[model samples]
Target: MSKRLFTTQIKLLESNPNIEHVSERAISYKPEFKLHAVQAYKSGRAPMQIFLEAGFSCYR
Candidate 1:
């Protein structure tokens, strides 16, 4: 089964600059953001830290 995002989560994600698009069940991040995330990961940054730095929340 696939999990879908709540309305509030969608709104929050939409407000982030790194997000290109957001829907109830899908979030599309920008290409530049993807590259940055990869680089950050290779540099030993934590996954959660990368997401937080990109304006994403951990709330569920």
Candidate 2:
């Protein structure tokens, strides 16, 4: 991901209530998986939507 978008996503993740409630163990995305998520987020999708559309269990 580009640095700008990556930073934005980090901020979004940090602020999101879903991430705040979930444990680290629930967020086990792989390297390529992360690339896909970032790609999705960069394409006008919300940071939260990437996780939801990708079926990450931590998203709940």
Candidate 3:
């Protein structure tokens, strides 16, 4: 995904407490969360896999 799209998606996931699809525009994220997710990915998890395991739903 493009940087813009990827950023928007990450923001949506951070803002939502439940697993749901986000159709809106860019969303916001806490700095701590962004750090955690990056750390998780660095610790041997696939990028998408980490988010999926964290309970964020992915839609096509």
Query: Candidate 1, clashing residue pairs?
Result: none
Clashing pairs in 3: none
TM-score, every prediction: 0.83, 0.44, 0.52
lDDT score of residue 45 within candidate 3: 83
Best by lDDT: 1
TM-score computed on alpha carbons, candidate 2? 0.44
At residue 8, candidate 1 shows an lDDT of 78
For each predicted model, how many residue pairs clash, with residues at least 3 apart or on different chains? 0, 0, 0
Per-residue alpha-carbon lDDT of candidate 2 for residues 18-51, written as tens digits (9 for 90 to 100): 3432233333345676787778878899877777
lDDT of 1: 0.86
The candidate, 2 or 3, that scores higher on TM-score is 3
Report each candidate's C-alpha RMSD, comma-separated, in the order given. 1.4, 10.1, 5.9
Q: Is candidate 2 or candidate 3 better by lDDT?
A: 3
lDDT of 3: 0.61
